[model samples]
Target: MRILVTGCAGFIGYHLTLKLIENGHNVMGIDNLNDYYDVRLKLDRLKELGIDSDNALHQNKTVASDSFKGFKFVRMSIEDRENLPQLFDHNHFDVVCNLAAQAGVRYSLENPEAYVDSNIVGFLNILECCKNHNIEHLVYASSSSVYGMNKKIPFNTTDSVDHPISLYAASKKSNELMAHTYSHLYGIRTTGLRFFTVYGPWGRPDMAMFLFTEAILNHKPIKVFNHGKLERDFTYIDDIVQGITQIVENKHTAAYNSDNLYHLYNIGNSKSVKLLDFIEAIEDEIGLKASKEMMPMQPGDVEKTWADVSGLERDYNYRPNTPIKSGVKKFVAWYKTYYGNSNE
Candidate 1:
């Protein structure tokens, strides 16, 4: 299978791309490599994928991997109207895993346009390209944040996600809607996985796990948001990649309401770990106590997030099962090795 994985330089995308490559699929990956977080981390992820950082400088140019022959990467954005279509026409990918988006929920509040461009417009471009290219499957990254202010204990796909608290979440919900429209109209097989709090090796710096680890190591005060009352279903990277691979291979043909072959499911660790416990896990891993600054919940933040992945397990026979302690330990180890005690 020839797979097109957008946001290849991203945390999840990089892991997924490597898994696909190891499974003997030819993968072409693309990312704009924006500095939403540290671009160096993205580059390091690409380096792990066998792409030379020096060779990935120019935009719209394909960079072949030196280590993995089946893998190739490009520096591009999904919002590019001309180049995206051109890439589709040239490659004719069998499947597209759309993971590229403006990621952070709080960041969306400050830079809403970035969310609009990447999550909304960019996702539309992906749908258009997939539609025109006769793609067999389109697997995309959705978010648990779509459950918003709902009082539901374990967020399910069947739950109403009409009220999103953040623009980032709203944009993700919009992606699901857009994918459904395309699937219904064009008979495309689309699956949206509502990811819970994903964390692991090569994780994003903006995420809670990374921030807590960094601050703890450097003796900086870690801000305990929502006064440490929050809970999250922190799904591990390996489990996420496994779920994605399963969904990508298992093409959906069932008529979802007689419109198109479309499905959405929660991909997460079923267990919701409390924020304080999570911090303690990090503390245990790094052998450091965090200086805590308790803070009120910022705008557009949810009190808790828990995913009901029964639907995914029923359909795909897989669920995220990584324990928070183990996940945090792996992340802390990776952080220490990657940064080398540099507080920069």
Candidate 2:
């Protein structure tokens, strides 16, 4: 299979691209490599895949990996109307996994325009390219943030997602709607995955796992938002990659058919962990106590997120099973190694 993975420098995108390459699929990965968090982290991720990131943005570069024979990477944005379509015109892709979006819920409040460009306009370009290229399947990233302000216990895909609290969530919900429209009209097999709090090696710095770990390591006080009352369904990277790979492959007996082409599912670790308990896992793994400061819940934030992945498991026969402690341990180890201190 020839797979085109957008946002290849992103946390999930980086992992997914590697998995696809290992599965013997020819992969073409692309990203804008924006400085939303740290461009260094994004560049380092690309470096891990054997691509030089020097002057990447300046060149709008396309570099093929020498290490991975089947993987090539382009430095581009999904919203690049001319270039995105040109890329699609030149190469025939069997599937497209659209993970490119301006991420971070809090940041969306600060820069809503970025969300409109990357999440909305960028995704429209992806759908248009897919429609034009006759791509067989399109697997894209949605978010659990779409279940905003809902009091539901387990955030199910079937739950009403019209009331998104944040711009980021709104943009993601819009993507799902757009995908559904394209699928219905153009016969594209579009699947939207509502990812939970995904955290692990090469995770995003804006996410809780990285921030807490960084704060703890530096002996700075970690902010316990919502006064330690919040809860989350934190899914590990490996588990996420596994589930996404299955979805991209459409290998399950109950996978989407021509009649059921437009689909959405919650991909998450089913169990929800309290914020304090989750912090405790990090403390236990890093062998350090975090200096904590209780803080009010930020705006556009939900109290809890719990994913009912029953539908995904029923159809795909797989569920995220990484325990909190184990996942934290792996992340801590990766953090220590990625930075200077491997002894921790």
Candidate 3:
């Protein structure tokens, strides 16, 4: 199968692209490489996939990987109306894993336009291309944040996600609606995976795991939001990738109703670990205690997020089993190797 993976430089997208390539699929990856976090990390991820960072200039030029014969990469934004269509028309992609989006929930509060440009307008371009090119499957990245302020114990796909607390979550919700429209009109099969707080090696710098690990190792104070009362269903990257792979390979076609070709599922670890316990895991991994700075929860932040992935388990036999302790240990090891603790 030929696959087009957008945001291939992103934490999840990079891992997903590597997995697809390992399974002998011809994969073309694209990422704008915006400096939302450190662009260096994104470049390093591309480097691991055998793409030369020097050649990854953001000019829409496609760069073939040096190591992987079946892999190619391009530095382009999904919102590029002209080039995106040209790429679609030329390549005839079988599947499009649309992982590209302006990601940070808090950052959305500062720069809402970024969400509009990448999440909404960019997704529209993807749907248009999928519609025009007759793509078989369109699997996109949604977020658990969409279940904002809901009193539900475990966030389910069937639950109402109408009240998103953040712009990032709202953008993801909008993507689901747009995808359903495309599925209904053009017969394109669409699936939206609402990812939980995914953390592992090559994780985003803005995320809690990365931030806590870095600060703790440096003997800096770690900010505990909501006075250490938060909980998250922190899903591991490998498990997330496995679930995506199963979804890609599974040919369970949706029902024949015009509006039935679209589906949504939560991809997350079912266990919601407390914030303090998660921090303890990191501390145990790094052999250090963090200076704590307890603070109130920021705006656009939810107190807790617990994914109900039974829908995913029932449909795809997916189960995320990586415990927070083990996951944090792995992340800490990677961090030490990559960023070399000078304090050691």
Q: Number of clashes in every candidate structure?
A: 0, 0, 0
Per-prediction TM-score to the true structure, in the order listed: 0.96, 0.97, 0.97
Give the winner by lDDT: 1 or 3: 3
Which 10 residues in a row give candidate 2 its minimum summed lDDT? 250-259
Candidate 3 residue 23 Cα shift, in angstroms, is 1.0
- RMSD values for the candidates in order, in angstroms, are 2.1, 1.3, 1.6
Worst 10 residues of 1 by lDDT: 251-260
- Predicted structure 2, TM vs. truth: 0.97
- Give the Cα error of residue 176 in candidate 1, in Å: 0.9
The models' CA-based lDDT, in order, is: 0.90, 0.91, 0.92
Candidate 2 local Cα displacement, residue 247, angstroms: 1.1
Q: After best superposition, candidate 1 residue 178: deviation in angstroms?
A: 0.7
- Please write out the lDDT profile of model 3 over residues 95-209, one tens digit for every residue: 9999999999999989999999999999999999999899989999999989999989788888998999999999999999999998888899999999999999999999999
lDDT of candidate 2 over 1-344, digit per residue (tens) = 99999999999999999999999999999999888988899888888777877745544567888679898888899999999999998889999999999999999989999999999999999999999999989999999999999998988888999999999999999999999999989999998999999999999998999999988887889999889999999999999999999887765455675379988999999989999999999988877899999999999999999999988898877667799999999998898888865324
Q: Give the higher-TM-score candidate: 1 or 2.
A: 2
Clashing pairs in 1: none
